[model samples]
Target: MLYIGVDLGTSSVKLLLMDESGDIKSIVTREYPLYFPQPGWSEQNPEDWFSALTDGIKELTKDCDKTTVDGISFSGQMHGMVILDEEDKVIRPAILWNDGRTQAECDYLNNEIGRDKISAYTGNMALTGFTAPKLLWVKKHEPENFAKIKKVMLPKDYAAYCLSGVHCTDVSDASGMLLLDVKNKCWSKEMLDIIGLKEEQLAKVYESYEVVGTLKKDIAKELGLPESVKVIAGGGDQAVAAVGTGTVGEGMCNVSLGTSGVVFIASKEYAEVDQNALHVFAHADGKYHFMGVMLSAAASNKWWQDEIIGTKEYKKEEAAITKLGDNNVYFLPYLMGERTPHNNPNARGTFIGMTMDTTRADMTQAMLEGVAFALRDSFEITKKLGVNIDRIRINGGGAKSPLWCKIIADVLNVKVDKINSAEGPAFGAAILAAVGCGKYASVEEAAGKLIKVIETTEQDPVIVAKYNKKYDIFKDLYPTLKTMFDRIAE
Candidate 1:
């Protein structure tokens, strides 16, 4: 049997085909244009995502027998607000998760509504990216559009609805919306009233591996597949990636250094919100997980290489850097503000302690180490919650760098394990589809059979001690510059 995984990303739609044995048979991607009407706002057309998926799937399955495809699932960008009218037409281009225009709405929730109440109710505080804030933004600014909202959905759930004729979302994805009472695994009535939305506007929530519905007859015919092809309710990108990396059960960890960075840790029991820093959400593995996000991870390095250094050869630039923890330069990796510990949109990137004697390699190493230290900030928070994680599975573009991997290992003082497949969320969604199709009994069983740790990077005690000192300095820079960042953004 074959399964299809759709990674609905910010810049493109990536489609992957995986067989029952976890081999990637074929993969294809299609890019779509993103619109920025203002400096801080981000928007995209839902039609573009649909078009990309249909075309990419056609190309991906051209050589294979499409009738053999057993299931389809998705791993998508979370917290984006997608609304449909009474006629099921898109009310407007989706307000993307990364959009920062909901500051006023966020203030209303965090201050007036109060963070303590929100945390107690939704297991998270109001952030500018969350769906609850976006809804409030529309109600205040675009009241006309607010009244026209007959149904509300996330980016991937919209695609699932189009394919299966079902309005549904998995628990993991719904947790990010601030509408679900995460601990009890149901919608929070208080949040619904606060957002001025009814329970009917929400989609039916299911476990990540549960089958929502089968493919619609017309969609199956168009793709030359059987209508019996089940559509599984997959999960948010980070949650699915954890399952793919076998970061299931208690104390298991997965660190993703993708376009955005995340530290995902699974726990056997429900953990409450702490300082509104780490996200408390439902895991795709039928458990609970805590996540900390940094808006810029690999994108920081990409910016330094392409926009600053004018080079596409990242390996070549990093190859010259041999120094690990002795660099004099320090980089604050806040190119896109920050998320985890400090939810400051006004924060800016800075290179501190740079001198004339600083070499190119020193600056490069600082950039890598700066990201590692920032990740450690979140790791510190997870420790405060009494969740002790000693090892983590690593994925994403930055995970390919040996030096960066070593930096992360020493800085966070945790074992870093590299898995065979680096497909992240898309591959994870495919595995969930396999589980839903009965190819595997549970998510943990599927991962145990499929995920292989090819290598492990252990922390060096001496270097870890050096980084421990460096991290204290790294942590202090953000608060010290908070006033300056706020003034400059004005």
Candidate 2:
């Protein structure tokens, strides 16, 4: 039987067709517009997502026997607020995960309500990107819209509801919402009350590999598929991407260098780190994982290459960056503020130590090294927690750059393994669908059988030493500039 994985991303929806054996039959991507209504605010029309997915799915399965498709699942951008009215209409544009309009709400949650209590309930502190804060922002700023809300869903859950006619979300995605009692795997009543929400307003939560429902009759007919096709409860982008890269078992790590960079380490049990610095969320594999996310990773590189350098030749631009750790130029990758270790939304990107001698190559090298160093900042916290991860599977667009991969390996002083397939969340969603259909016994079993490393980048000891020195300097820049960032924001 075949399975379809829909990766509902911030930029596009990518549909993947895979057989039970894990071979990818076809892949199609459809891009949609991302709206920026104001500075630091990001929104999207949820309808655009569904439209893209339907079109992409038709293209994805055009050459195949559609009747053979047994199941569908999703991997989606986490923490976007998609509220629906009583009539099941979207109340407003979705407030995205990258949106930074919830600072005041986050401050109220962390300071007024208390971070300790929030952390205890959700296994994470309130952040500008979290759904709870976004909900508060809506209630305070858009009371009329809040009054009309009957259901709250994440971006992909909205799509699942459209397809299966079931309002549901999985544990992994719900974990990022700050509405789930993550340690207990249920909605937090205290959090709900605090946000002036009721439990019924939230979607039913399920495990990532559990079946939510079958396709709705109209959707089935529209897609030319069977109504019997199971819709598996999928996961958040990072968690499902972990499955895609085989980061399921205890202590296994996967580093994603997508728009945002993350250090995801799967753990057998729940373990919340100090100050709730790392997100301790339920994993798709029915386990737990610690995640450290930076608001901008490959995005910093994109900004530099596209907006600054005025070119799309990423490879050619990166080719000029030869001296990895020896450059004096330093960049702080806070293009979208930051998260993880430092949850400062006021933070801004900075370039320091740039002299007249600093070439475009030197600044470009700084941007790449800066992202690696930020990831290392998260790794440092994980190490302090005694999670000894010596290697990590790397994925996402930035990972495609061999030079950037080597820099990450050297900067983190760990071996980086490149998988044969870089499909990330879409592939992981298919694996979840297969597991939901009983094609695999468990997520781990499916991942171990299908995901394979094609190449490994080992850290050079000499380069590691050079990066260690540079990273020390890089780490200090953020703290030193924190006050300035806050002042500038004011």
* Highest-scoring model, TM-score: 1
Residues forming the 10-long window of minimal summed lDDT in candidate 1: 268-277
lDDT, candidate 1, equals 0.91
Q: What lDDT tens digits, residue by residue, belong to model 2 across residues 173-212?
A: 9999999999889999999999999999999999999999
lDDT string, candidate 1, 308-401, tens digits: 8799988898899876778878999999788888988788998999888998888888988989988998899889889998899999889988
Could you tell me the TM-score of candidate 2? Answer: 0.91
lDDT of 2 at 376: 95
TM-score of each: 0.94, 0.91
Q: What lDDT score goes with residue 273 in model 1?
A: 57
Best by lDDT: 2
